[model samples]
Target: MRIVEVYQSVQGEGLLTGTACVFVRASGCNLRCWFCDTPYASWRPEGVDLTIDEVVAKVEEWDCQHVVLTGGEPMLFSELIPLTQQLANRERHITIETAGTLYLPVACDLMSISPKLSSSAPALASNPHWHRRHQRERCRMDVIQRLVREYVYQLKFVVDRPADCQEIEEYLAALEDIDRERILLMPQGTHPDELADRTGWLAPYCQIKGYRFCPRKQFEWYGTVRGS
Candidate 1:
């Protein structure tokens, strides 16, 4: 796998936030969201190359039950199965953070699929190459359907406006196979307050719609400081 950075940190988001965890951030993403906070992992080269055993050893050193395989899009690298296998052997719980752009056929304890809506406006302005690339290559929503169904698989989206909610409903409508209760909505914000500002409104929004609200737990506790 092409690894960007690996470190021991608390789970920063989703259901596992604040849990002691080992993070494996792989290099090279297939998308370019304009507001992406981890551009170091995406647009720039900020990674070191390491063998699978070396990476696994690092996780063992952390000695935690939670191991999060994240990325630039860890799915970009296929050797994740080997690492997951090692973690499984050690009985560590493993979670995969993916953009739902690519399909994964490996085993995982949790599949957190965050599908990027068109309103994400990835490459909306600066990415001269992204617009063409986005159109040329098909973006598949089918991956969300095929995740190891043993886990209901959580769904999240970064939203900045009310229109984004409508988009989520439309997307979910297309995938009638997915249970609506599995989806949670959170507003987009590089910082948590941007998330909190609309929290009052969003909670009711989700309540009225019967969806769940997800706060960016990392930001709620630690503000802008990274890697809690």
Candidate 2:
């Protein structure tokens, strides 16, 4: 597998946020969001090469029962099937973090899909609409369809302002059939204080709307530590 980095950290996002997890950050991504956190994996090649077995051994060292296979969109790797299957065979619980930009044919325990919202414009005024319109129809919906077919996938959105929630609602409404408990809204930030500040806005939004609110626990506790 083409791995960018692997380490132990609190799960900073999703349904299992705050839990101890072994993070397998794989390389490469399909989209370049305006506020991307891990540009090194998205735009740069910076991971050590490791075979499937080597990768598995590394997970064992984190000494955690739970593991997160994330990315520059972790679904970019085809070997994820063998990797997750091998890990699960050992009774280790696993989560797959993705953009839902591609169909996930493999069955993992949890799928935390953060669909890029319209507010992350690409400088061009029409980019957000074009992306939300075509990108969702072409990739994201197919992901949702496939995910619902086999695994539990959550719809996690990152919002910065009230306007962002408009686009988020548009996307969520399209997935009206999804179980409400599986949806989450989080604020975008690199630090815990930032998330803490925006949580006041987003947390109430979720509570009132009956959707889930996800806090970035890694940041809450360690503020993006490398190996905490």
Candidate 3:
């Protein structure tokens, strides 16, 4: 598999925010979001190749119980099956961060599914290839539905504006048995100041909708640097 960087960092988003964990960020993505923070992993893939055993060995060095298999869509790799199994064998709590556009029968303690909304679509002028490809592959409702039903999950949506809230609501309404509490609405920003600016309205929106408001605590604690 194409391995980006493996490191120890506090879980920055979702229900386990602030929890110490090891992150295995896989390079390459099926869809490109306009605001992807880890462009090295997606916009222009970068990383060395590592076998499943080597990846597992790296995670073991952290001395942490929690592991996050994130991406540029980590689900894109087949090595995930063995990777998750190896972590489970060690009793490490596994969290798979995915775009929820694809699925693999990998084991996970928490399936962190971040479904892209219309707001995530890039403009036609901004690299037409990715713009078209991102929109085309962004949402796979069948995949999202199956993931939520099969795994201990959380549905995280990146909200940039109040209008995006309606789209989220509509999405949830269309899905069956989606737990309201499991829904996380995170402000779309990278920098601390940028996050703060959007949190003003987004936090309130989450409150009113009975959804959890997820802050990018990593941005506040570690700034917008690589490896958390």
Candidate 4:
């Protein structure tokens, strides 16, 4: 796998927030979101390539129970199947953070699916290719359905504006068997003030819509630094 940095950090988002965990960030993505916080992992992927054994050995270096297999999109790599299997065999709680656009029958304790919204696409004038590609590949209901059905999952959306709330509603209506409680609405920002501004309305919206309000605690804890 093309591996990025592997480090220890607390669960900064989702239901497992605040939990101590080790992060394995794979470098590369299938889609490009304009507001991507980890641009190094996605927009311009950077990292060394590592075999499954090397990756596993590095993960075992941390004395943590939870392991987050995150990425520019971890599902892009086929090596995850055996990598996750190895982690699971060692009894580490495995969480795979993906965009939910791809599927892999890997061992995952939590399938943290963050489906990109239409607004996540880069502007057409700025990057026409990625804008069209992002729109085309962002949503995959079939992939989402299979992921949710196969694993314990959470659907997280990054809300940038009030209009996004309605889009999320329409999105959920189109999908089947989604647990609203497992749907998390997080503000789209890497800075504290930016997150705070969106949180004011986004938190209330999540409450009214019966979805979980997710905060980017990493920003608060580490201030948008890499390898948090």
Candidate 5:
């Protein structure tokens, strides 16, 4: 597996926010989000490829009980099957953070699926190639449905505007057996100031809609720097 950074930190978003955890950020992505905070792991990936044993060793170095298999898009790697099994054997609570476009059968305590919205696409003026590719690859309802049914899951959406909220509703309606309470709406931003600005209205919107409102607690507590 190509590993980006393995570090101990609090779960920053979705249902597990504030939980102390070891984050294993896999370094690659299938879609490019314009607001990606970990661009090093996505838009331009960087990391050393490690065997499952090496990656497991690094994770064991942390004293945390919860482990997040996050990405660029962790589900992209076939190595995750063995990696996740190894982690589960060690009895670590596992959370897999994925774009929800791909599905892999693996052990996961929480499948944190953040399906990219149309707003994630970069403008044509910015990067036409990624803009097109991102739009084409972002949403896969079939894969999402399977993921939700097969695992304990949460559907987390990054909300940049009010229109994005409507898009999420339409997506949920299309998905079968989706629990609305498992849906989390998080403000889109990498910095505290930007998060605050979006959270002002986004949080209330979530409240009114009865969706769980997620905050970027890591950015709030540790700022936007890497290894948070």
Candidate 6:
């Protein structure tokens, strides 16, 4: 599997937020979001290839019990089936962060699904190819249903604008059995000021809509730096 930086950091998003965990960021993604925070793992993928054992060894380096198999879309690598199994055997709480666009029958404690919104598409003028492909492949409702059904999950939608909230509502309407409390609406921005501005309104909306208001605490805790 292609591996990016593996480090121990407090869980910065989703239901696991504030918990210390080991992050195994697999390189390469099936879709490109314009606001992607980890561009190194996506747009211009970079990493060293490692055997599944090697990846497990790295995660074991930390004393942390929570292990997040995040990506570039970790589901893109079939190796995750055994990789997640190995981690589970070691008694680590596994969280797989994905775009909810693919499916792999891997063991996981939390399936952190961040279904891409239409607003997340990259500018067509700058990158027409990825813009088209991203839109085409971003939402796979079948995969979303499977992931949520197979694992304890959280649905985190990046709210870039007020309009995005309505889109999220429409998105959720298509699915069944989704717990409203597990649905999180997070502000979209790398900077604190931008996040604060959106949060002012987004937080209230989430409250009225009965969804969790997820704050990107990593930015406040460590700025927009990598390995947070």
TM-score, predicted candidate 4 vs. hidden true structure: 0.98
Question: Which regions of candidate 5 are displaced past 4 Å?
Answer: none
Pick the winner on TM-score between candidates 1 and 5: 5
Candidate 2 local Cα displacement, residue 78, angstroms: 0.7
Worst 10 residues of 2 by lDDT: 130-139
The alpha-carbon deviation from the true structure for residue 223 of candidate 5, after best TM-score superposition, in angstroms, is: 0.7
Model 6 has an lDDT value of: 0.93
What is the TM-score of each predicted model, taking all chains together? 0.90, 0.87, 0.98, 0.98, 0.97, 0.98
Our tally of clashes for model 1 stands at 0
lDDT of each: 0.75, 0.76, 0.91, 0.94, 0.92, 0.93
**Which is superior by lDDT, 4 or 5?**
4
Q: Write model 2 residue lDDT over 21-109, tens digit each, in one string.
A: 88898877777666677777765646877888999999998669998888787887888888888998988888888878776466588
> Which tens-of-lDDT digit does each residue in 116-191 have in candidate 5?
9999899978799989999999999999999999999999999998899889989999999988889999999977
RMSD of 1: 2.0
List model 3 lDDT by residue over 25-97, tens digit each: 9999998888999999998899999999899889988899999999898999998998899889999999999
Candidate 5 lowest-lDDT run of ten: 9-18
Point out where model 1 deviates above 4 Å. 123-125, 135-138, 148-151
**lDDT over C-alpha atoms for residue 157 of model 1:** 74
Error of 1 at 84 (Å): 1.1
Q: Candidate 4 regions off by >4 Å? A: none
Query: What value does the lDDT take at residue 85 in candidate 6?
Result: 95
1-228 per-residue lDDT for model 1 (tens digits): 778767787776667767888888888888876667678777774788778898888777876888889887888777877778888888988889888777756568888888887765556467668765654432466666666254547787777778778888888877746766767787788565677777768778899988878777766666665455
Report lDDT (Cα) of residue 93, candidate 6: 96
| Residue-wise C-alpha lDDT for candidate 4, range 1-228, written one tens digit per residue | 999899999998999999999999999999999999989999999999999999999998999999999989999999999999999999999999999999998999999999999999999999999999999999998999999899999999999989988888888888888888799999999888889999999988878878899999988989978898
Local error of candidate 5 at residue 107 (angstroms): 0.8
